[model samples]
Target: MTVNIPQLRAFLAVVEAGGFSAAAADLGMSQSAVSHAVASLERELAAPLLVRSAPVRPTALGERVLPYARTALTAVRSLEEVAADAAGAMTGTVRLASTPTVSQGLVPQLLRHWREELPRITVRGFEGDSAEVAQWLENGTADAAILIDPPPGPGVQLALDGYRALLPRDHPLAGEAAVDIRDLADDAFLISPNGCEARVREIHRLAGVPFAPAHRVRDLATLISMVQAGIGVTVLSEVSRPLVPCDLVLLPVEPRTSRRLVLSGPRARRWHPAVRALAESAAGRLAAVS
Candidate 1:
């Protein structure tokens, strides 16, 4: 089978974007072109890859072949980077994923550092909840990701920010230097399910406090707004302090708890050269500051 890079790219884009039109927009090609590429790929392979439904899902064969496709594309990108690196000017786009808080708090600085270190590499940002960010990295949608509490291997530790108790200005515990989770048990507890819920729950569990949150908010902004309006109190990372309104207070949990933020390339495939460069840049920055 003579499967070309364009056909592989078109297939992956279609799967990632969910439809030909969206894939075309992402790939900067016409819809017809994307369709022709995939069709040609199918013809060459002599099997249907996609089911072509409302959102366009992959068939069983497509599912099995997708990982190999990603591997092939990653390898090709690495080859291109090899040539660029030889000329001393690396150029490519690396899609980086992160949670909402990390995106807001750390991504700007990280991007700036990367730009200064690897000027030719364009790093695109993808923000999602923890699960979605992890999914993007696994599914080849992202070349690298800032993973929270990632497994210990093949990644750089970016930052370690502790989770803090969020309280309203007028709340009694708000003035304390460090508030115990048990101290706020009487208040209507709020939590965001975005990425930090498990950590929050673990904090509560360790403190012997109930883990039931009165409000399970999805958006970080809305959760902070709720706390500001005296709807309830919550716990969030210290990194999220900037997102909290001034009226809401963030106090260190009495027994401080922190989460590790790591930056790493895809777990399933070879690291794109730009991703490797980005990780090295971040590590060097951290080492310099330390």
Candidate 2:
């Protein structure tokens, strides 16, 4: 049976918007029109696609069909745009997944360059932990990922970046030219919620000391805030140092813990031009900061 686009749109709208009237409002059609479209879709498929209630719920058949409908619509839109671009036209979509700290710190600079250099390319950003970033890249949810301490995965490319230590300006170690991991062993540790635990533990193990975190934070901003409040000192990549406000001093850490910023995709060379461009730009930016 031929499924109509209008009917599919209405069905997806109701599934997204929860009720017939809300979907109608969003689609700028009357509630009756929305209802009729869903009915037509159900009739054509010879099944009840949705359960009518206070909030409309999708039937098993509806659940099965919804993703296909969404994917078809997305593919159609992408193809139409690609056709409009034709040959020699630089235009496509690039989805990037990165850790939250990088998302708040390094991504803005990269995105600024991307918008200027490739305005036609659509960019989507996902912020998560290293594990989540790696999962998205492996599962094909993201075209590329920026991560710290990412797990070993096939097709992943890694770049070594410099490190920074977040400490209160008045702290004794702040007066030193550079702080060493061993010097801070006695100090309370403030750790990044993601990947920091493992990295810190490894650093302690190497220093022959046991590591314990005094505070754990998910966001770079929060981690800096905690450090500024004298909660504890934490180490972060140099790229994230700029994200912290001036009230907190980010000192260079000596014998720096080498941090890896990983970039992964289905294939490094086969990535979309926009994705490749952004990845190169990110690497360059990090290198300059380092």
Off by more than 4 A, model 2? 1-86, 149-159, 268-270, 277-290
Write the residue-wise lDDT of candidate 2 on 47-122 in tens digits. Answer: 9999998799999999999888776655554464456445645566777888877787667777887788678877
lDDT of 1 at 84: 65
Tell me each candidate's TM-score.
Answer: 0.85, 0.68
Q: How high is the CA lDDT of each candidate model?
A: 0.87, 0.73
Model 2 — TM-score against the truth?
A: 0.68
Q: Which ten residues in a row have the lowest lDDT in candidate 1?
A: 81-90
Q: Predicted candidate 1: what Cα RMSD to the true structure?
A: 2.8
